[model samples]
Target: MPFAELDQPGDDRGELVGLLKRLGLRTLGDFAALAERDVAGRFPNDTIIAHRLVRGLSHRPPLRRALPPELAVTERFEYPLQRLDEAAFIAKALGERFFTGLALHSLACTRLAIHALTEAGEERVRVWRCAEPLTASATADRVRWQCEGWLARPDDRPTAGIVQLRLEPEEVIGGQSLQLQLDSIGHDVDAAQRAARACVRIQGLLGPDAVLMPVLDGGRGPGERVRLVPWGEPREATQEDQPWPGRLPTPSPALVPRQRQPVQVRDAVGDVVCCNDRGELSYPPAVVVVGDRPARRVIGWAGPWVYRDSAFAKQRHGRIQVSLEADEPNAGEVALLLNGAVGERPNWHVEGIYD
Candidate 1:
């Protein structure tokens, strides 16, 4: 008989061992001399099994229950599920079944593994781990979320409908005790769980690239100081040293592109007053038509101030560009401006502005 079958609640292993240890009946032959009723009276609940074991009647029966190598639940669909919604529904069901089995064993899972089989016989698998053991509903929700992510990828979609789904617990561990001192600060594990769930769901529907977080790169330039990366990836929280001298203490919220347009400035008297080049502006301006005609004029001017080139994009020509803000009444809106010389016309183009 399998060891698992012998380990059942009413098996003679425990009582026989206990009685033998107490009476010094170490051998099976010694135990076989004991009367059935005598052993039966000694252990009320397991007497019959204990007597059989003492009589050398092969107390172990054929294996009745089997132990799984690992805790898992699997479902094979008669029909393949083609839609993401259908797959998610099946995932949820599988999650519940998987968790139900774990709960029966008084176990909680910290890691979840999902597997999918397509009608074309292709298999896809994904694994996720959490900091804490999760409930059945939470586990199911996470499985669904992970399924959506796998389905969202262009290269990951199965050629045929998904015909198989499985959820397996990959890790099991104990839960941590809550800290009483941190209660007033409102930091709790539930919030983390909710955030994890939300992230998984969003990533499932929109792909992992959709979620991002800011990281510090530790350089003097706007491009150098900040970087965008996937939400869960580890990144340095702060920068240590400056890359260049004369860095701005306050960085602008937005990073405008380097390429811009150039413009010829004409004054109110209809004379070419100035040509603005290599200039930068902080904001957009109000635009109007010059001389009441269709031609636009910049009414307000801000800056031709120079700044360092963006670190995010490489500068091939090695020239720093200036940003400019201008108001053009002809455009009938305040806008931001960038100018680059366009074949001697010195064309003026509106970039964007505050409302």
Candidate 2:
């Protein structure tokens, strides 16, 4: 809304009164009923004056004229400002004012507000929150950049141009004379602000969804266990209700899926031995050969294991046969001995490392 629009009697004043009523304050008498000092203490600045008007006091001295010794400054522009650059210039001037004021009072403003008087007379405001109060020039520069950014967007423009710019100190804290700590914090804050600004710029150039982060999900299978979400959104915590069947307490470092290999078996008499897919040696004197190297001897072996191939959708059949052994050339090593039809070479593959 424009500042000028605010001046028309029925427009702004009625709206403001309506807002006060929404806040449970109705009628001029309701505001007048409160003490002036109490009103100022509770609401501060123009808010108190606005309430006073509701109580029927039209003439009140501007609060700026009576402000205490603290770093604060305000500037009013005569001509309406249509461009962001012009507004930034005014902001810079206001910053200078604040610094000058602080210098006089021997204090600085840690937080400030850059307020705009829309051509329609309505106020549009932006705040500059700093980790600490800063020197006048630095404060002014920051305010200028902030105002420039706020006004840069076409949607931010008031129906009317902005006519006045003001910078006011909302809070103040003592600054160090040496400034070593202040400089460190300032660098960190400046870096963070710059990064935020860059992110905004990138989002503007690319659609918001163009940037994203990966989200981890709790599930037994690979495909069911991962997801993606917006970069800024918090990651979802692991679900407590769901149980993971056959999941290990400690996960394997390498989880890549590998192709299965087959192994050959022969009896002590060199007669070929055959086991059904269930991994049992058909004859008791069977010796395993891994890549043409005969086993030193047949030691204790675990099973002709059967695994369903249905878990891997891309494979033609879900049938898989495996064998486990405790004694082999690689003692204490877990070897995956596989089975295959004749004419197809048998294969042996190591699947894991156990300490």
Candidate 3:
């Protein structure tokens, strides 16, 4: 139940969840730890339920209804799945098909039951509970994580290949609340407009900063580019289009640390990498070590770019992009943003991580 999954809350869906996820919420504990008032200040819409759900409280039956048996979708694999990854791959398609069926009925499900049949004639089952309707992709991921957890027990691992999988909708509600309804036909609520009104109401209650929203601003750094302002205000950027000479090139980092972590950048000869008075490197960066993380070889890089309006600025720093073997949860090529003062001292810090 991470913040990303918060949007998949049994009765919630909107840009609010996305915002929190981007703010570095990694698990249910992270969001649940926040004060309800702080969350309400940003979302304004019914975040009370999200706070309750994150704290493991159930408002389930109050917002959801019983689903019909027709919403279940099953699939028999042509190739039996011996590993959890194979089962996970098949679940993705099954989830999409299942939700498609639900959509036809103008319904969405909050609780789901996953059933599996093995070639040895054994059966496995588990139920997934969400405070809100989950997207098809989220449903598939939940099943995959469940399977991985179950399969992780060496002694309890399935003895035979899985031949069939079934997804059943145990609880459901009208599909209307999951996304903005723009159809001009019926009495469907305009979700976007309602969210705006909620923001206004919250601002009136908590004062102007009660509901702030993010707007992109002109800056060379990804962290500086994001600006949170009071909601319902004009977010005009007069200089975003202006060229920033030393800005780190796109695409931007996916994760920016709340605080910059001290790091060591080394050269080919094992000497610490440092910049000269002219902001040029003493030697090209060849390796990087952030905090206590394993050293990563710098295979590719850009910059040593400086940030200052004038050469004499005391608060100036240089930025660099280094591509290395990923040290992240998911194994992919990672690019790091590093910052250092514009001087001979070899101090450096990790500015961002591209996942």
Candidate 4:
């Protein structure tokens, strides 16, 4: 609501309001009802200004005075915080106050950093990031989670009691853009903000690396095309958009092993299958042995797709994907990647399981 005093009677305006009153204009509403052109002509420049103020077009104390400083709310303990519960309560109260200040200014924090100082002068700091603006409840939950995790780790706990806590906004956006109308963000925006909050809490409980977000990059291989980064950390740049010759064709493999596991592919004649120098398989796969599992017959197989790495000689490799005749428990229509090069027997490993 607009300030009531802007339109109230007996405001400290001098002779202008006195003349308006003498002219039977008692309230600001009476002055506002006058035509702008008439008000501009009948009285001094202040009369036009008063009319605009009454109509809510101009602020009594203007909004253009100065932009507020960045949000940095701090709470200092007279007696240092000894218990985790005490720190958590302080954090909750701080979050409420901090976000409340932002709300008053029509602003919201997109990135926030938490700083904790111990009596011994040691400090622990971590920044939390979000795609959408965070709510105060989410901010408090994150703070509590972080405090709990720090207390739980005896090795990393504060040497002395914590004397000060600080919450600083690293980045902020206009809250009006996000809060002006419900349809501006839709329902998914709320869900996404909640999910981000949960992720922040989980990351606090575990280490930062525990929660990762996938980033797509330009690369020839399936594994190279995507990377996982820890939450709140900046993503490393890669040639993700670059076109490369001799890259594997899409649709790429759904599963790629983090650590390659070795197995054996055998022909019906009990000969180990091999990829020749010409990138051709010596024999069709019949039996597959994966990590001491009973040999399963091969149902179908794809290719000896060669991948050449000009930068590294040892990295040059070839791969063949095959379907197993017998499915492993919970792995329907199991597929295996047999990867190797010429003059060496190919090693079979589970690639992916079709649903």
Candidate 5:
């Protein structure tokens, strides 16, 4: 017989098997042959006990029933809540009640869970870890944050309004008096509470997606370098952790237009300037025409940085980015991205504007 049954998926005892194998013990017979004192000295006491049980020398204890947490509260809506604000309002009230209940027992919540049921019978749940025991206002902030994330995603939206909300304490600790510094701890906590409340109010007024937070991400271009995510959503740490090459050099552009704008570069006699396959310019640019506006004289121009699209080699082959400066003081410098290889008919669009 096998000394250990560890071939199953998600087997956590592979380390134990490896350790025993390293000690030249592959089967129960080999394990049983070892002296009990030797086994105890070589490995942990638990392993020695397990070996004893397998040898019929020791017996196992009876399993005990697990108990659920004591602090849990649920609220049902008379009219379902369609707006996130409405749900947040109810969640705040529920948080107050949850804390009050815990206070009666002289306890504090260290691990919190929030659950919601939509009219469509879909259930959503989230758990939050508290560094320390949380206060009532802090609990409400967490509830608001969870609700915002739920309502922000389009597919996660309820078919009807949410009909039920539940708050449960996963872990609790004995309540203790907190010694706080007035200027430091108290001020910081108060400021954070006010900010969290303000964020919820702003999200309620402007809509969830409207109140976004900037997240840094790895990309080769200016616009791709920054990702905007809904305020309550978690931002990945790996976004800014990885090294990104070919990013625009600092002083970065003030404006990066998501929608490409058509622009033309022309020479002195109004001949449209272009690039050739040899990565050479048709002529030194003399004028720049943006949309229907009159052409402004070009003072300086730089770069034709080539970027290859390895993913779509057939369609969007590559692009060349160039920065142009116009003579008119009002017309600031702008960056242009042109599609096609150096030697083909180039199609250009405005990429960014610098102040």
Candidate 6:
């Protein structure tokens, strides 16, 4: 974050934050990148706190490594859950364990992803984004509510007994940071909860499908990574959790076209660049042409990452990130996400754009 946007209390008081900015340390990452000892040498007055912050470590008791913002607490049922009311009973015990685990690490959950599995191999996953850090009672309440809601929907209820339940913390904050929503200085603390309540009310007025939330699912192609689910329904994601080859990393394109536009990548010899079944690029991309427009020079590129479904599957899907020289007719930097499909030739398409 920017120097002015540091969440620390004294950071806004204009001494340390300003000093860091003057030294060209604009972001939190910039400070964290330097060695903790270097930061201590720079700020001798606040050596302890500054050094700790420089390492991106929290103020909690020291550990082998910094506590991660999120974690998962899983429970396997010896006696599978067959009845709907039984979930409430399970929730109490599970919530206690969940809270205790978070307490041990001095962390609190802001967003929670609940995963439930049934004896018949059915899996249901839902994520709840909360405005406040959830307590043990609140966690149990949410579990009971979610299970009750799913049971009320005949189509969504599990066919077999639930054998496993997992609570994955999606977003977390410091355990010591809990404060009153309406403080002396006016702030919109209830905004998130208000918005959630509004969605629930809308679902009541209309149908469950009235509102939808987008989830970043796992897939090789940019278009396949986004999965939209009904407002309160459990997100269904099979291609999300598993570690698969050719999956693109973070800094995904901000905008993705609904349909993949035909595009062509070529080498300096004007021959089409191809990705083989094993994902080896025939040649470095020199030019990229979207439709019949003027061919743009390839300045930067990455991948031709390939995804193989299984041993029996013959198809090989691949993707490449290509940065093209922008023309006067186009906007600033032109970066395109290209996808190659299975066939005799590399049929490229504009999967998305990093404008």
Ranking by TM-score: 4, 5, 6, 3, 1, 2
Q: If candidate 2 were superposed on the true structure by all CA atoms, what would the RMSD be?
A: 17.9
Model 3 worst lDDT run, 10 consecutive residues: 199-208
lDDT of 4 by residue, 1-355 (tens): 3234454565656666567667876677777788988977887776677788778786344556677675788889899887878968987898898899888888888788888888999998988876667678867877787777776777777788888888888888888655546565556666756677777778887878899988877765667778888876666657756766556655667777787667788899999888765667888888888877788888898877776766566645667777887555775667766566555645555543333
Estimate TM-scores for all models. 0.41, 0.35, 0.44, 0.66, 0.58, 0.46
Candidate 4 residue-wise lDDT at 177: 51
The lDDT values for all models are 0.57, 0.53, 0.75, 0.74, 0.68, 0.76
Q: Is candidate 1 or candidate 4 better by lDDT?
A: 4
The most accurate candidate by TM-score is: 4
Residue-level lDDT of model 5, residues 1-355, one tens digit each, is 5756633366456777778888787787777787877877888766766667657684444568777446898989899877868867987898899989998888888778889898889898776655457688877877776776677658666567778889899878887733354666435676865765676556544555756777767665667777887655556545566554334455556677878777777778877677764446778777777777777666556655554444454433233445666547786665555433444455566766766
Q: Model 3 over residues 243-329: C-alpha lDDT tens digits? A: 876777788888889997999999998898887657688899998998898988999988788877445756678888899876676
List where candidate 3 sits over 4 angstroms from the true fold. Answer: 1-189, 241-243, 309-312, 328-330
The sequence of per-residue lDDT tens digits that candidate 2 reaches over residues 5-122 is 2235643455555555676755456656778888778664656656555555665754666646644455666787777678567766777777777666666665566677777878
Q: Which pairs clash in the backbone of model 5?
A: 276-342, 276-343, 277-343
Report model 1's TM-score to 2 decimal places: 0.41
Question: What global local distance difference test value does model 5 have?
Answer: 0.68
